[model samples]
Target: MERFWKPLLHFGYQQAMSCLFPVIIFVSLAITKVIDVPHLPDYDLLFIICLATQYVMYRSGMESKDELKVICLFHLIGIALEVYKVHHGSWSYPQDGWTKLFGVPLYSGFMYASVASYLCQAWRRLDVTLVGWPKPVWTVPLGAAIYLNFMTHHYVYDIRWVLTALLFIIFFRTVVTYKVLSVTRRMPLAVSFFLIGWFIWLAENIATYLGAWQYPNQREAWTAVSWGKLSSWFLLVIVSFIIVAQLKHVKERREEVPFRASRDSGQEAKRQA
Candidate 1:
């Protein structure tokens, strides 16, 4: 029974790979035209690629399902909050083309996946530390502070999503860094990716809407940014750092048995049958 279930789980994950992942990338980019993905939504394509990337990170070791759930929550919640702000008019899109009729932009989910894929790609090299930036005084505030000074004329309002994102950055820089980078950690890439991605949404909650970079058919918010804008940018940098770290941890653990145990066991069991 033990052998049956273990191998079954392994087979299940593999089967899932043939479909579970990659639903976002190919489908989204084609729909949004961020890049040239065909319109079919490439579930298998994305899933296989994600599987490969996930495996590379697995060298760091297997993670718990629970951990993946937490990561997903962080990503989904953070992103959903961002869409709320975008919908509320705290910021605006560059073009109507990229904007969706939904409360947030449709491409928002793609943005989430893009960040996740990037993290998985580098799952091997993405280590992080919360230590003060090399020039802590400057690095601490560069993301937001720079944006604020650069766009003083902008209308940077106080959005809860942006604020939370900012707070998460500070926490990540000084706290979450060690947890994600260390081998003992068990959260899946999804959870780590989501938290880190949520942080990204939190930071960009305003920038994307405020015209930090214009979307299709959207007008730039010349005087739209405020102090809060800076906070959002700051969070983005921190999230980026952590995602990379998780990716690294994944790469480092690949050689270990637990990471690939399921796959091997599955293959062996199939042969026995």
Candidate 2:
């Protein structure tokens, strides 16, 4: 029992740490919903809090500079998606803020950034590695298609189910290896993606309850988000994972190049001697 519980506790601790950014965002959302501040609308206040939290995370070395860059990229990507979704009547901010673009609040991007932050933090904390990762030829195009489908589906055919089928086919053999304390664990990459997506769905419910955003059905009165959205989040998680994995792969290759060069130079000198 002691042996089993020890690793479980460590796993929980790491997960909680990885969730720091997300936890902060949710707390801000809840607080802003209840509290009133002079000259600061709730949405703008949430934005300021998010910005400060990001700066502190960087300054205190909670997140590396490269990870921060990834978060920023996701922030912009999320904002673009939000603007499109709002325009198409998918959802609405339903609040006024100077930081809002079109109808979506600027702070909403941080919600997406928190997802990237969690992925980066968990990857580091768990010492995660991939087995049988698909080549970029397969992954890059799939990722691009998934993102584009989010917007195009509104106008053209909704190919989300097709893309999801492709996701399983592409990642079928992939396994994610992660460490929990001294123990290492393995999970199928597809299963991990589903699990993360499900949890994000759960978090979305909480966020909506806290007045983060509202669907058409939720505008008049709060109600559960549609189960159909789970598939959307599942595919979105894959997109985030692919982007981070590609960056990590590129960084590893760049680091290997210098090492290989030095090794070859040493071998040449040995032959000369």
Candidate 3:
């Protein structure tokens, strides 16, 4: 319908911005051999995908006062985790060639930017109904992600880590949900971001598991066989759906409705009095 075109056009512009600069970067990288075009890891391509998604969220028009804290949290979480993992030899590359992105370690900026970008985008696009502030179990997914990051990589058989991961996710979800505290069409950006962000992460996990990119000393994702990988995927997809729904469609609250004439009427009455 005619009404639909407006948002679509907006989304189109957003989608374009999301991809444009990245494309230029990709071309430049390729031209100068900044990033070798390879099948493994797919870092450059993934980064672009995330960037596009971020723009999509930008176009979605969702605003949160807490957005800055959320973004900062991502930087803190991402850089810290990456540094720690690399420190512990949790995962490593076979060669030492990726050392050019912003003068940080090869995977450092790209990884953090990729992850944080997607999170912010998806958060902005999440269904308000699903992302309650200070909710009951929001952290479940975040913690799971961190936990999976650890165990899945090193084959560390720590049951405690698994439990801790689950608990962490629950706590994270709780905190995020608490921020909004109600599941409405007005969920916080963090929850939505997590939903979509995780799906993209699943892509990385699946690809790596399939040997599309090798993680040193890691086996195929057979552990997923034991612990219900498919279920996790399903949950993640469901969360993504909530986010997509929020991004594409959401209901307005009564107070949110601008009362142009009504406001004028109230103002006139106040002036007369």
Candidate that scores best on TM-score = 2
Candidate 3's residue-wise lDDT over 41-140, tens digit each? 4444544544454455446643243443443444455555555565556454333343323222333343444343443443454322333333324443
The 10 consecutive residues of candidate 2 with the worst lDDT sum are 177-186
Q: How close is candidate 2 to the true structure, as a TM-score?
A: 0.98
Cα RMSD (Å) per model? 15.6, 0.9, 10.3
The Cα error of candidate 1 at residue 182, in Å, is 16
For model 1, residues 1-273, the per-residue Cα lDDT tens digits are 975586556544443343222333344324434433454333333334444544543454443343344335435644564566565555444433323445444444434544544443333233333333233343345434433432332455534355455544544443333222233233332234445445455534344343333433345333433445444444443444444344444545675667589889999999999
lDDT on C-alpha atoms for all candidate structures: 0.43, 0.95, 0.42
lDDT of 1 at 157: 53
115 in model 2: Cα distance from truth in Å? 0.7
Better of 1 and 3 by TM-score: 3
C-alpha RMSD of candidate 2 = 0.9
Most lDDT-accurate candidate: 2
What TM-score would every model get versus the actual structure? 0.33, 0.98, 0.39
